[model samples]
Target: MKKIILLLTATLLSTGVFAQVKTPQPSPTSKIEQVIGLTDVTVSYSRPSMRERTVFGSLVPFGKLWRTGANENTKITFSDDVKINGSDLKKGTYAIFTKPTKENWEVIFYSDVNNWGTPQKWDDAKVALKTTAKVGTLPMKVETFTIMFSDFKMDSAKLNFIWESTEAMLDIEVPSKKIAEESIQKTLAGPTANDYYQAAVFYKETGKIDMAKEYIDKAVTMRKEPAFWYHRQQSLIYAEMGNKEKAIEAAKKSLELAEKAGNADYVKMNKDSLKEWGS
Candidate 1:
């Protein structure tokens, strides 16, 4: 009787303890958002804290496809056409995946991002660009996902997606000034790029003669746009050249562009300069 009673007591204790216990859940993953100049990029992935005993060849095998990150597949998107490793990749979003090896890793870009694993056939990866990176000697490990642009410049950057002991990089370039000029010609000259006209007035209005001249050229290259900005630029040039009458003529045109652009400051400044020249 006592044995039966004891057994019943033990069973109740066990049930109570079991009922009170709760399993631990993984922490929420992090989201990375970044912009490389005109290119807006975002990377979303999950990560768990891992240890020497818990990761690498044991947890993640050698020479196998890693989702590049945990949970959802890693993804990257570009707002414009960019060069990845000197290879032109059109504007699109892609999944960043990789194949691990003993000494190096095979980086991959997949056209299909929603899929969970790397299917044997890679026809779906339309614009795949392959690159390799070797393991670091210090046994570096990354617990969370990361993405960044290294070697950033006014017009270019090196996009690096790094984790664990491996990394992959791709070069990216923005539209250059020449390209902007060509764009003007191709579209058969508009008041768009590389034009000096209204843009010069805008620059003068904004207190940036240098930038104004730069962009005005872009606009002039566009053609059929307001020539007043160009004439205004010419006026400024004449003023600098000590040609008072020519300067006055150019200022009048500049006034026209600024007025059209609703730029009050340029009109005031040019009016003052013309008065000084007359005096």
Candidate 2:
């Protein structure tokens, strides 16, 4: 009976130690993902409300680096290289820090992002890019902090920061036109060697012998370097087209290349096919 009471007391003590009471966070976390032109942009931060307190030149202060959000570091990521205020920023995530004056705000993208709120020792070497944005006042009061994308276009967009009545905007540019033109040029340049080879394989599987023969011949001619698999496919296509002489020639080439490449499977396959074809 004593042992049983002792076990129950221990169990109750353990349960008490592990018990937790859930409560709402003072500042909630937020994540925003947006596609500006061909580039992907993401922002993550915590939003702290004004709650009838003075925001600028008071709580946040002036001429000092602000974390730009509550709790963890405010981070922004870009999928492609971008330009901010005519300055180049490479593709990656960066911690956003800002220094606010009465008229203008200096926005910074820091290379280091792992921090609770701000780094213990500020390092100027870690600053990737810095640009100044003019501050504007909103007509009405804003209760919570917000970061948003506005004025979106095919190649550019505006990143806006709003808290209380203060507003600042950052102009961001992406290489949408350059990326699009490159893609269009590649498409207009016609099929590559691998493209022809794949088409030949598809046609051969679907019982289109004439088309397979044409595509395989183009693949073999267009290839910059000799490939054993291309020759093997060419041999198969020629054999299917009833060209025994060309088939034997291609099989011999394939066998030679396969041996040089040290591919035992292709070597054995070419030898078996050559014997069956009476070569």
Per-residue CA lDDT of candidate 2, range 81-130, in tens? 99998899999999999998889899999999998888999999999999
lDDT (10s digit) by residue, model 1, range 25-86: 46246666766665666666665455434455656687887877666767778777776656
What is the model-wide C-alpha lDDT for candidate 1? 0.66
TM-score of each: 0.49, 0.74
lDDT of each: 0.66, 0.95
- lDDT score at residue 73, model 2, on the 0-100 scale: 98
Point out the worst 10-residue segment of candidate 1 by lDDT.
Answer: 189-198
Q: Give the TM-score of candidate 2.
A: 0.74
Best by the lDDT measure: 2
Q: How close is candidate 1 to the true structure, as a TM-score?
A: 0.49
In order, what is each prediction's RMSD in angstroms? 14.0, 4.5
Where does candidate 2 stray beyond 4 Å? 1-20, 197-220, 223-279
Candidate 1: where is the Cα deviation over 4 Å?
1-27, 52-54, 117-127, 133-141, 164-170, 173-279
